[model samples]
Target: MNFFKTTYTSKLVFTALVIFSSSCSDDYLEEMTYGEISPSEMTSPGNVDRAIIAAYSLLNGQYDASSSAFNSPASNWSFGDVVSDDAYKGGGGTGDQNNIHLMEIFNTNPTIIDIERKWVALYEGVKRTNEAMRLLQNSQEYDVALKENRMGELYFLRGHYYFELKKIYNTIPYIDETAATVNDYAVSHTQYTSEQLWDKIEENFSNAYERLPNDQEEVGRPNKMTAKAYLAKTYIFQGQWQNALDAANEVINSNKYSLLPNFRDVFLPENDNSSEIIFAVQHSVLDGAPDNYNGSIGDRLSAPGGPFYSQYGFHRPSQNLVNAYKTNAIGMPVLDNKNLAEADFVDPRLDHTVGRPGIPYLDLGVLYEASWARDLSTYGPFAPKKRIVSANSPYQIKTWPYISALNYYIIRYADLLLWKAEALVELGDLEGARAVVNQVRGRAKDSQYVMNLEGTTPAASYRIETYNTPWTDQATAREAVRTERRLELALEGHRFFDLVRWGVAAETINAYLEVEKTRRTHLTNANFIEGTHNYFPVPQKYLDYLASTK
Candidate 1:
C-alpha cells in the first residue's frame, strides 16, 4: 500500500492508543475492559505499521494535537522565507496573522504563537516516531528483516524531525525511545552543546544509512541514498566540508536521481515523487477527510487570490527576490544588490517561481494581474507560484481553502547539488564547485522557458547561462554558488536558514531592509540583529514546562 496516501483512520487509532496507554496507573484496580486492547496487546506488527504511518503523517506539519495549521506549516513559509529577504507575510492586512508579520520584521519573542506551535508540531513528529520505534522494539512477531528496515525508517524520520528543530531553534532537547517516562521526556535544551546536537542528529542519519535498503517498494519511503543526502546536508550545516563532500559524492555517484528535463515540471503534482525529489512530505486530497487536512493544508493561505484561487493571499514574493533574478548582457547574474527594472532581462525561472504582474500564472487562462494579490499596497504586487497547484489539475481541491495534493519537497536533487557545491567552495575546490553549480544552471539554460497565453510568445526576456570560465578566485566562486541557490530554490523556504548557516543573515537581511523600506513602507522598522536573531528563541512555554517538572 502507498503508506502516505492512506486515510486518517490510522492516525485516529494511534492517538486513541497513545491516550489509553498513557492513562494507565498503578493506583487503579487491576481490571480489564472487555472490548478494549491494552498497550501490550496493541504491540503487533499491524499496529506498528499504523504507528509508523502516523509518524509519516506529521511530515506535512498539520497535526491537530496542538497548533493552528498555518502556525507550523510544513513549508516553513513564515519562518524560512518571510523572515528573510525572499517574501512578505501577504494577507488582508498587517493585522492578519500579525505574528508572522512580527516574524517578518525579526521582532519575534519566545512566546510567539508561531514559535511555540512549530516546536510542538516538530516534537510531536519526534514523539510519533519514537512511539513507532517503541512498539517495534517490543514486538515479538515481526519479521527480523522487515523490522530492521522499519527501524531504519524510524531513525531517518526522527533525524528529519530533529533536523528541523535544530535549524529553527538551534539547541533543542533531544529525546529518543529510551526516554520512556514522563520525567525522561522533560530533558533540558542545555543538555547538549549545539555541535553535540548536530552530532546526535547525524547519528540518526548514519544509522538510517546503515540499515535502509538501496530501494524501497513504497513510493514515499526513503532509501539509503536519501539518508546519505541528509547526512551530507547535516555535514554541510556543521562546516564539515570533507565529510559533507564524501557523503554528497556517495549520493551523486549512485546514479539514482537526476534533475527533471524541465524546471517547471519539478513542482507539479504529477511529478511530486519524481526522480529529482530525494524526499518529500507526501500529500493527497479527496482521501475521505472532510476538511482535506491530508493535502497541503499548512500552505493553503499561500494561494494567490484570483478567480480560481482562495482569497487568503499569503507568502507574497519580495521585490528584492524579483530583482535578484535579473541577468547581465551575457546572462550572468547581476549580484551585489543591483536593482533591475521591470524590462530587464531576467532568468526564465523567475516567471515559474514568482507570479509577476502580466505573466500567465500556470494553466490559468488569464494573465496574472496586480489585483491577484491581496493587500497589494502593503505586501507588494507579486505572489508565490512555485508551490501552487494549477487550477485545472486534479490535485487542486476547489473549496474554501484551495489545498492541493502537491508534495512539499524536503530535499530535491538540485538542493543536494547546491549543498555539494557549497562544500566544494569551502574546501577550496573552486573548479569542482563551478562545475557542480553549472549542472544546476545548465538545466535552467536548456529547459523550456515559461510561455505566455496562447503559447505565442516568451513570458519575459528569458536569459540564463552557466559558468563557462574557470573560477580563479574562491570568494567569487562561493558567492556565485550562493546566488545560484537563491535563483534555483527561491520561494521553497530555504533562504533564511541558508543565510543563517552562512553567517550572513544579519548583514544580508539588514541590507535588504534598508533598501526594501524605501520600496515598501511596512519594512521601515524591520531589522535583523546578528546575535539575537541567529535562531528563534526556545518557546517560553516549553521552558516553563521544564521548570515545572523540576
Candidate 2:
C-alpha cells in the first residue's frame, strides 16, 4: 500500500502527557482532532467528502501493506528466486548468511506500521460511514441508494479489513462500531474462531456485492465486481472451492473488465490500470496532492534507489526463480529437466519474475519524467526485472518525496481467471484449468518476451520468438497452470500464502530449511518446519494484555 497515494489528515501529535496522563480532566491534553477538524465538525457536505477521501486512504495504504507483508513472508519470493532469504524481516537470520532485515526492519517497516494504522484507520472509516448512514437514513438530503451504496462500501471495507486482520491474527478485538476511547478496544474484535470469521467475511462481501454500484467506475473504491472477486478470493483462501468458483464465474460472466491490449502497460502509472484491474489504489502525482512518502516507499526497491544507485539492495530475486527462468530440453521454460537447446524458450514470465540485466524498467513514471528510468537498451547481457522502479536510480534523481504513482491492484480480473483455473483443478476438471492458464501465457509476448519467426532476420542469434505452447494433455495442462501462476504472480504478495493455502508451504519451506541447514555459513542452522513459525504465535503481548485484563 502506497501512503503518498492520497492526501490525508495531518498527523495529530499530542504531548507525551496525553498518553500517560489518564484523568477525567479534559484540559490536560487538548484533543488534537486531526489537523484542526474535529470528527463532530465533519458532518458538512465538504467534510463528508474529505471523510470519504480518508476512507479511500485507509483502504489503499494501510490495509494493503499489512495484508501483503506479514500475512505471508516475502521469503517466498526472496527465497523462491533465491534472491534473499534474510529479506524475511522475521525470517530468522540464516546462521550462515547475515540477513539484512534484522538490521533494516526497525521502528518503521511499513509492514508493522501499516498493520497498526490499518486497524485504527479502518475503524475511523467505519465511524464516518456509520455517521453518514445514520444521517442519510433519516434525511432527504441524498438518494437512498447513494447513501446505501456509501454505507455498503463502508461495510464491505470493514469486512475486508477484518478478513485481512483475521488472516494474520486469529483472535483480534473486533471493533465493528465507532470507538471513543482506548478502553472501547477491550472486547475481542473477532467474536469467533477462524471459521466464524470466514462466515462473517462471506456475509459482508455478499452485502457489498449486492449494494456496491456497478454503474460507477470510481478510481479507488471497490465496485460490485471487485466485491464479488474479493469474496471469491476469501473463499479460495478458506478452501471453499465451489464458492470460489461461483464468485469467480460471476466476475467472468459480468464482462466488466478485460485484459489490457498490452501487459506491461497494466503497471504503468499513466495507464492508471489495466482493463483487467477491478480495484486499484488510486494514486497520481497530479491528483492535486503534494509529494508524499508513501508514494515513494518503493523508491529503495527500484533502480536509482537500488543497485542502480544505493548501497543496499532493496529486493533480491532468488535461485528457484532463476531456475524457473531456465529453458528446458524441449526449448521451453519448464520441463522434467531444462537441458534442451539452451535456447531462449525459457518461460517468458521470467522477466516478470526476477531481474537479470537486460530487461527494461518500462519507465513507469510517465506521470512524471517520461523516462527517468531506463533498462530497455540492454547495454545488454541477462534480462533484468522492472518490479522495483527507483532501486538503481539515485535519490538525487528521485526525491525525498519523489513524484511517483501507485495504483496497487487490490483484486484484478486476471486473478479471477487464476481462481477459475484453481477451481477447475480442485474439481478434477484439468482441461478447464488449461484453458485459463493458456490465455495468460499468450499475453507475456509483448510485455516481457518477444519471439521471432523461424526464418526471420536476427536468425537463431536472437530471433527466437516467444512460443505460446498450446499444451495438449490435462496432466501437462495442470502443471502448466501451476507453473504459470508460480512464475506469473511471483512476488505480488502471493507465494508464501499460496503455498500455505495450497497445503504446500510445509513441504516447500521445509526443503529450503533443510537446504539452509547445510550452508552453515551465514544462513546456516536456521530452521522452519511445517508449523511453529509459519503462523504467528498470537503475539505474546496481546495474550498478556488479554490475560491481565480478563
Candidate 3:
C-alpha cells in the first residue's frame, strides 16, 4: 500500500506537504529541488511535487520484498506460507490487529507494514493530488482543457490511493481534501460505511478513467486505461460485476497496451515502462533519484544468504500446497488422497510456484535439499535451491553479494488477465474466462525454471510445467483462479488477503492443516476464531491518540 515511506515524523512532514503542495501530474514529485526558493519564496507547486514523491517513497512498497535480493521479513518468519499457523516468530507487534494474526488469515508479521505505510502514503499522495486538484479547480495557470488533463492524473492518484487503501484496511477514514498540519490531521478518523467508502473510491477512479490519457509516452504514470484497470479491480471486489467487466473492457479496448509476447519480459527492467505497463512505481536507480532495488521482494526471493541477505526460506512449502500440485499417473492436475511413492516428481507446478524439491535456482541444483531439509549432502530425490549462500564474494563491499536484484512487479498484464478471467467467472462467463486462462497455461512451459534436472528417472517432455488452472464451475473456477493466483503470485505477498476476501479461511485452511499435520507444530488452532479473523484490530496505537469525547 504505502510502497516505500519511512518514519512517522517523516510521514507527517511529507504527508502534510503532500496534502498542501501544488503540483502538476508528471511534475508532481519532480519539483525544482536544486537551488530553490526560501520558505516565504516557495509557492504551492514547489511544495506539492516533492511531497508526492515522499508518499511513494514511503508507501511500504518502494521495492518488492519477495522478489528482492534478500528477504527482510525476518528469516525465522513464515513469510510466504502465511495464513497458516504453520509459520510464526513468537513475537507480537500488531498481529492482534483484529484476530487477523491469530487466525493466520493475515500475515501479522510487520512485513505487512505495506498495509500501514500505503494507507499513510496514499493519503499523502492524495494530499498532493488534492492540492493540485484544488489549485487547478480554479487556477489561472492553464485553460480548462489543459487543467483537466493534468487533473486527470491527480484524480487518478487520489482514487488509486483510496482503492489501494480500502483493499487492505476495510473501512478507512476518508479524506477528500488536503491535510497540512497537526490540526489538519484529525484526531478522529472520518467513518464511511464500507459501501459508501467504495462509492467514493469508485467515483475517484471513474473520474480518473475519464480524465487520464489512454496512453502516455512515459511508462509509470496513470493513464485512462491505468485508471480503468484499477477501477475494474475495485468494482469486482465490491461485487459490482457488470461495472467491473465494463471497466476492464475499457482498458482492453483502448489498444494502448498489449500483452508482451514472452511472459518473462514483464519482469525485466528494460522491458518495463512499455505500453503494457498501464501503471507501475516508476523506479529509477539512474541519477540516484531513489528507485530502490535495495529492499525489493524479487531480490529477497532470489538472493543467496549473506549479511544483507535475509534467509526467509524459514517459510516452506506446506505439504498441502505441495500435494495440491500432485497429478495422478495420468498427465493432469488433481486434488486428492495420495501416497508419496505414487508422487514421483509428478506435478511440475509445485516447482513452478515454489523453489522447493524440483525447481532450479541458478547455482543451486534443486531446492528442497539445498535449503530446508538441512541436508548439505548432495542430497536425496530433490536438492533444494539453497538461497542461503555459503559462497563468499571476493570483492564484497555492500550488504549481500550472491543476491539477485530483480525489481518487484506489483501489477502486470498477466495478473490483470487473471483478474479479468476471475471476474468473468463470477459474472457467469466461463468461455470468456478460459480464453485468458489458456493463454497463460500455453506459455507456462517456456518458464525459465528448468523442471526435471534430477535425471535418475524416466523423462518424456514435462520440463517447464507452470501452475495449472483447469476451467470449472463458478465456485470451482473461483477456487482454481485463487489457487492459480497463490501459485503464480506466490511469495510476492498476495495470498493472505485472497483467503480473507474469498471467505475461505476456516474451510480451505483447516482442511489443509488437518492433512498437513506439520503445520500444527507452528500454530495454535484455537487462536483463529472465525468472524474477527478477517481484519486487523485498527491499530490500537492509532486509537489511543484520539481525544476522549469527539
Candidate 4:
C-alpha cells in the first residue's frame, strides 16, 4: 500500500540534524556529532535524494499538532465542501469544532486557530521544497539530469502549496527560496493582487513543465503532463482563455492519460495510480513506521458516525448536493427544484459520491441508515462516501481505523477535460466545448451505476445522458460546464473554489441557505457576504509575526 515504495532511511537523521543546527549558538558553533549529518554533509547524492523524499512527505499535511480535526487537513472537506452548498459540518453538534461551525455559517474571523494551522502547515510544505532545492544546488554527486529532475519536483511542489494558499486566502504573502529567516514573512499580503498571485503560480508550473520528464520512475512523482494540467488550471483560474486552451490542448495531444472506465474505481485504493489521476497526495499504511500518519488523515474525522464505523461524522452531504444529481426526463440535469423522489432519472455519481438510507454502502454489506448520522437534527441523513475507507479494503490501517491509504487526487484527467471545456466556452467555441463536456458525460453514462444487495437491480433510477442538442450560446455552455464540475468533483473539495472563480459564491450560497434553512433549521442564520466572506481573512498571527520584525 505504500505509494512511495521506499522509505527515506536518512530522513530522521537529517531532521534531527536540522533541528540541532537551528538551536545552536552562533558564537559557539556546533560540529557534526555522532550519527548526525550537517548541511555540508547533504552534498552526497543519497542524502539529497532523501531530502527530496522528505519534501514529498510534506504533501500529506500530517503531523500537525495545532488541532486534531482541522489543522492542515489534506481532504479540505470542511473548508471547500461545507463552505459551499455541497456538504454540512456534521459532528456531535455545532459546539464540536466550533470554529468550523462558524466557518460553515460565515461567522469565523481572522484570529481562528484552524486557518492559522492550515497556513502554517502549507508554508511548512513550501519550506521543505525550498530546502530540497537548496540542497540540490549544493549537492556534488548528482548529474545534470538528476539535478533538473529534482528542481522540477521542487517547483511543482511549491506551486501546489501556493495554489492551496491562493484558493484559501485570495491575498497572501509570497515567499521563496530567498527567505533565509523568519523575518521574510514581514512582507505584506497586499503587496500583490490575486491576479498577480495567480501569475506567480503560473510561473512555477511553467518552469516545472519545462524541466520535468514526460514520465517518472515513481508512480506519485509528477511528470511533464502533470505540470501542464496545473498550468492549464491556473490559466483557467486567471481567465486567460487562449492560454488555458493551449495548455489543455498540449495535455490532450500528449495522450499520456485518460478517464478510467468506471468512476468509482478512480477513488479505490486498489486503483491508486490509475490513468485518471494527474497528481495526488500518495498515502500508505503499515510501511514499518511508528505511526500511520501518512494515511489519509483529513478523512479520519469523516468516517461514518455509528457503532459500525465509530468515527467522527464530519462533512455530511447536503440535500442540495443530492438534488443536484437529479436528472430530467431526457436525462439532463434538472435545473429546477423538483421533488428528488419524483425525478425519473439520476446521475450514477450520486450513489458513488453519497451514502443515503437503504443503499448498500460500498461493499460493507450493510444498508445505510438514518442512524448512521451523528446529528439528524442538524446534518442530514446522507454521509460522504467518496473519500471514506471501505471496511473491506486491505489498505485500511486498523491501528487508525478511520484512515485510508487511498491516494487523494489533487488533479485528475476529468478535471482537465472540464477546464478545456470551460476555455472553449469562453473562446466562443461552443461546439468544441460540447465535445469536451460530452466526453465526460459519455464516460459517466458508460460507467457503473449503483447496485442492490441482490446485485440484479439498480440502486436508484440511474440514467445520465450527454447533451443531445448542439451549438448552445456561451451563457448556457458556461452554466453546463459549471454544473458538471459541481457533480463530477462534488465531495472531493472543489465546490467553493469553483463558485468563487465563477464570481457566484455569495449569490449561490445565500440562495442555498434560504432554501436549506427550511429543512435543516441549524442553517437558519447562515449568510454569505459578497466581498468579505469570499475569501478567509489572512490570519491575525501571520500579521503579528510580520509586525514583530519591525
Predicted structure 3, TM vs. truth: 0.72
lDDT of 1 by residue, 386-490 (tens): 989999999999985578999899999999999999999999999999999999999999988878887988988988889999999989999999999999999
| Order by TM-score, highest first | 1, 4, 2, 3
TM-score of each: 0.95, 0.74, 0.72, 0.93
Error of model 3, residue 462, in angstroms: 3.5
lDDT string for model 3 (1-550, tens) is 1222121112213223432123222322222233343444233454443434434433233222222212222121233335542222222222322332332543353334333333444555656555556545544534656456566777677776676556656666677655445345443444678898888888887787788666655444566777778888787776677887787777777776666655444555545455556666443322122333333322333332222334322234445555555554544455673433433544444453444433444333443334443211211122112222222322111343233222334556666777787788888887777777666655554544343457454222243343354455677766666656654554444565556666776676666656544433434343444665554444333343334223
Which residues of candidate 2, in runs, are more than 4 Å off? 1-33, 36-40, 60-143, 178-181, 189-191, 286-291, 294-312, 329-344, 358-384, 390-397, 401-403, 446-479, 513-522, 537-550
lDDT of 1 at 133: 93
Q: Give the candidate number with the greatest lDDT.
A: 1
Against the correct fold, how does model 4 do in TM-score? 0.93
After superposition on all C-alphas, the RMSD of every candidate to the true structure, in Å, is 3.9, 7.5, 7.8, 3.8
Q: On residues 1-550, what C-alpha lDDT tens digit does candidate 2 reach at each position? A: 2333445432222122121123432331133444555545545555554545545554433323222222222112222223222123212232212332322211122233333333444444444444444443444445556766776676677676666556544455555444444454446544577787778778888888888888564456677887988889899988888988988998888988877766655655655555788776554443443334334333223332232343223334433445565554343455332222434556555544444433333333111121222322111122224344433332222443443554556566676788888877777776677678666665654443422223233212122133355545656666656666666666554565566566666676556545543432333434445554343334333333445555
460: Cα error in model 2, Å: 11
Return whichever of 1 and 3 wins on lDDT: 1
The superposed Cα distance between candidate 3 and the true structure at residue 468, in angstroms, equals 13
Model 4 spans > 4 angstroms off: 1-36, 63-70, 342-344
Candidate ranking under lDDT, highest first, comes to 1, 4, 2, 3
* After superposition, candidate 1 runs with Cα above 4 Å error: 7-9, 12-36, 65-67, 336-339
